[model samples]
Target: MLLKKLQLKAIDYKFVLTVCFFLFFAPIVAAQEIIPDVVAEKPAEKPSGGKLKIDGIIATVGDYIVLDSDIDKGFLEITAQGGSIKDITRCQMLGKLLEDKLYAHQAIQDSIIVSDAEVRGMMEERLNYMTQQVGGDINKVVEYYKKSSVEEFKTYFADILKEQKLASEMRDKIVKDVEITPEEVRNFFKKIPKDELPTFGAEMEVAQIVVEPKVSKEDKQKVIDRLNAIRQDVLEGSSFATKAVLYSQDPGSAPNGGYYKMTRKTPFVKEFKDVAFSLQAGEISAPFETNFGFHIIMVDKIKGQEVELRHILISPTVSDAALKEAKERITNIRNKIVGNEISFADAARNESDEKETRANGGTLVNPTTQDTRFELTKMDPVLYSQVSNLKGNEVSQPLLNTDDKGKKTYKLITVTNRIDEHTADYAKDYTKIKELALKEKQINAIAKWFDAKIKDTYIKIIGEYKECAFANNWLKK
Candidate 1:
């Protein structure tokens, strides 16, 4: 588990990209020259507020990359988010970063992987939702950010994606397989004081029949040709950025005219990375294919080991025929379910392409918890779209929807239950406590695993951050 304990007055550090100072930036060096000695034993204040700088190399258990720039960027992001920076000590912040890295590093060694599409899909949905929440002025946000354009925003956001993916991978290892026996739940209840027992609610179970609209070969070729045309336009002197802004399907880069960062060995669809790494500085790529569709890439700049570039992706259009077929198939499934012929579970196993939930008997699983219950708080975008208008025992007309993944799909949902807000009980909520107990057990397992790793590994914290507070108690020694 990647645990971050933000003090109520704690300094919250997001993730940052570390940069080694080069002589090219005279101002960066000048700022450093005016600062206190790097060799100082005690923390000192800078001219602007009580900002403190630390010198050190910190490695996660599995040894994922960490740079001082990572912490520095985190500091900037933390302050930008209106965090209480002053009260949080440098060492305290460092500890959070270290904890994140430890889990991220371990996830890599554990062979936990999240797809690039999943990362970008999540990022887009979040941004879109936020934009909707705030009257859709994305431009205002970019300007307020002190970032000149959406390109700069994507650069900052990419770091966010990496940390999120790393955290997600770690969590899968920590919690995905947890199972709590009846005895364990009872024992956990005994441990919880009577007053502290978690309350439950009238939980609901839901089922669905899903159908994904398949893209046609013609649609795919059209996307490829479109990207090829864009590449040609760039070669013919039309601004590639302008074209991207006008037509890119990647919401993250579409508004920015396609400028975003690309780093060596950083996570990206292999095709995109392969095309990107092959280009020299300022080179434009021909159409390249990835699961997302076709992309045209332009290398903006190549810094020693990292490459920064912008790209435009054109999605393969879902054909009308394919979409109709998807809806018709799903509608048939829904009719069968409504008619009460085959069980929804049996239908899901035989027909639903959603591997995540089909195996669970066609029950809607909370993406965050993987539980087959409707959690009002953790409702996914897809679920919200389907369930917001549905009443219990009612089936939705086949909806043209998008899944958590970027693929187009149709959903025929049957809401099993809905309850107005009220207090909860054990008969209805034992599963919730059982889940908590299982999570607690998992945490204990991970803790034991962490201790064993610390005993076997070599770690060194250099320079200013000699003392740091990490979640792993072993770090204290």
Candidate 2:
């Protein structure tokens, strides 16, 4: 198994902040500059009496000061998520805070800059995730924060977000090239106590040749005609929003009457973005075909590269006859391979409509491992059922597969390999175990860099925090 791209779950505020930066603005961050560190401005609150109690600065890394409130908020967030407020946990959180500031300072010295727009985009994704968790209601979040609007909540978290993006970028810079060899992996696995060894569930390797049913000209015309009729209705004084609510297939924006607030750099599909940007304000586009089917769009307004738009997407219907015909065609191809008329690979290359796999003879590459093997537990449910009981070299009957976008395609499957559930084995589990070794090496590398930086940079800890056992010797001079 190859080391898969890291999948981050919500760990804590710090982890969520950093990882979300990685997830959301990944493409833009790569092309732009390394980014941020600073907490948002504290909104003005009622001042205490003349005998003011200042929130004392708890620690300092370089010239960046960590306030008591910062530590309190960090601790509160973790505890709110069921984490214990132990001394060690507090120490750990403080260490992270110091490290984040160090990264931000270094980023500034290195002249790495993240734009305001990037920060806003990152904040939007975080808010969206929170909104989803609370049942897709933004108002709940707003009420929780006692804010008038979602935008205010974003402003409150803006500085923290900037810092996270910067710190994450800096950390990535440190561990970008770390790798582990086979010997290291083996040694790492050997060190694990036998009782602690991981047991894997059933896994299988499957390959497929897929064929998408061709949309008949009649069906394609039906979609185009429907969109054109809606356009005609709009031209004849019917409200576009009303028609979109009734017929638009884009669920995301359809409920809001197909509205979208988009920037020029918004990550729309290339085909959709091209036509959307070309249209003048108040102009309606003719029916256009994209990968999602057909769409008729209208530009509500334009401000520089930013635009407000409404659209109605109409996906072309796939007739049952067309689906049956596609299944028959694939079924015949599978028959040919089984009858030894042509090899599976030859048939795959000649007949498979899946361009991504056809050239490789229909070998399905596991997205997680980048190998031809798959962990059956992780395989698509629809695909899994077809290959679950097949022995080695056995082909599966024709089955329908639906992609992420709900596009239907038919495929013939072959179970190329399988592994029974078992405890970790050195030879059999080398690839899976290699990831553990690589992660350990990467952690050590980061720790080494951090220790060296602590020595070279100005650092201070209050007497109270100094007593706690910290992973890093922050007090070492």
Candidate 3:
């Protein structure tokens, strides 16, 4: 769909630049003020032998300054991430840098505080990823980034990351309250010429009833006991990180020694947060069960509302008998639905084990669009494979599924709605059309905010950069 394509482009524009900026680490130079109309001096004659050119400030937006080297660094960052700089220019990089500075500066003026702990946690994760990329060699990271040591690299990037975070928060604040009404959605759709109406891809609404293999009490106890044993080892002078690496079943944290920093507002499960917040620094929590598995957490430090901790998770092993039983259960449910003895939605509500879909009568909401319809081309590969061939009210045979956490389940799926490729219909595609309208409204709000801010905020473009055209009025003219 043209609307879908626009949405993808907008998302790429929003995130790609920020990601490129963070990928390359550079030294921040001091700001030097120059009169707005003053032209920067050209370099004087050099010796026959080549000499290094000096870096200087090219532009200043509010309290932040853009360095000549920053443009070069931006190019390097993009190239490092496999992006082409063939069509990119220094002027374009400078414009982006100026925008980011404006946002960051405005954020500080608004007293938007991003805590040091949050920045430090992000810095650590980035550093770990970098080091891992270089074969787990910290020295390679320093050498690749041309830093004298790891600490210097961390310090420079930490400041950069903080500014980036501030800029992001400020940008979000600009359009946070922007909303669109039904009239606006209709008007927005009406503005598109009939010949230009976007064609939506073939899509279908799929529903499923899942039955997870149940873990026996003994199997669950075995997991709890294992976590307890690991906790005892940590208390008796073994490294918790080492134990986590060896035994924790949580793939996300196991490699990083199960480290996580969290506050009360963090999205960790309530059971996990309760146990973590209840423990004092240096105290190890008793084994506890959550939907993911069982975990034993040790609080490393406490800073106000935030706590740094390490945890090891162990999921109970499902017996083959349990898997077979799950398959049989789902198969029976499918047979009942096919035979018309029970309605599919009613069976899901009464018999499905998956809490997420059970209450919704097994209907799946597409994560991307937050709707029931999934565009065939854009659907997740695994889901497409399962439901692609089904037509009408044909219920699929029980299919075994493995989740990201390696949990096993069996499901029966059916397609409730299917729409062939067609030009956008105002009444039928109202939800999608509304999203497009809302996004346009939000973009306008952001543009207006930036226009007002540019006037109120101090900005100066110097030298040859003053000639380059920018989407925004950074020169305040």
Q: What lDDT does each candidate get?
A: 0.62, 0.71, 0.79
Across 86-143, the per-residue lDDT of candidate 3 in tens digits comes to 5555655676788788889999999998877667656655666666666677776666
Winner on TM-score between 2 and 3 is 3
Maximum-TM-score candidate: 3
Q: Give candidate 1's root-mean-square deviation (CA, Å).
A: 11.3
Model 3 TM: 0.80
lDDT of 2 by residue, 1-477 (tens): 122112221133345354333333322221111112222222232123332124688788886888766655554444334334443244555666777788876766666666565565555555555666566777766565446886786676677678767877787888889988888887778777777677877887677899889998889999999999999999989999788878988866665577776886897877888889989998889999887889989998787878878899988778898899999999999899899999888888999998878998888988777767678778877667787778777778888887654679899888767788999888887777887578768877877887888788888887456555555667884
lDDT of 1 by residue, 1-477 (tens): 111221121122121112111111111121211222222122332122332334334444445545555555544544433333454444544555665666666766777765554455445544554455346766655553346888787566655566556765685667667778898877776665555444444445788767778887888888877888888888989998789878888876675567676575677877788889999988988887876778888987776877767788887878789988998899898888779887767888888877667887668766555666776655665566667777766777877776433568887677666754554345666767776677567756766766776666555554434444444653548
lDDT-wise, the better of 2 and 3 is 3
What TM-score number comes out for model 1?
0.48
Higher-TM-score candidate of 1 and 3: 3
lDDT, candidate 3, equals 0.79
For model 1, the stretches where C-alpha displacement exceeds 4 angstroms are 1-191, 236-239, 259-291, 298-309, 319-322, 353-361, 377-385, 388-394, 402-408, 416-477
How does candidate 2 fare on TM-score? 0.63
Residue 156 accuracy (lDDT) in model 2: 64
Best by lDDT: 3
Candidate 2: regions farther than 4 A off:
1-57, 62-88, 144-149, 179-202, 216-320, 334-346, 376-394, 421-430
**Order the candidates by TM-score, highest first — what do you get?**
3, 2, 1
Cα RMSD for candidate 3?
A: 7.5
Ranked candidates, highest lDDT first: 3, 2, 1
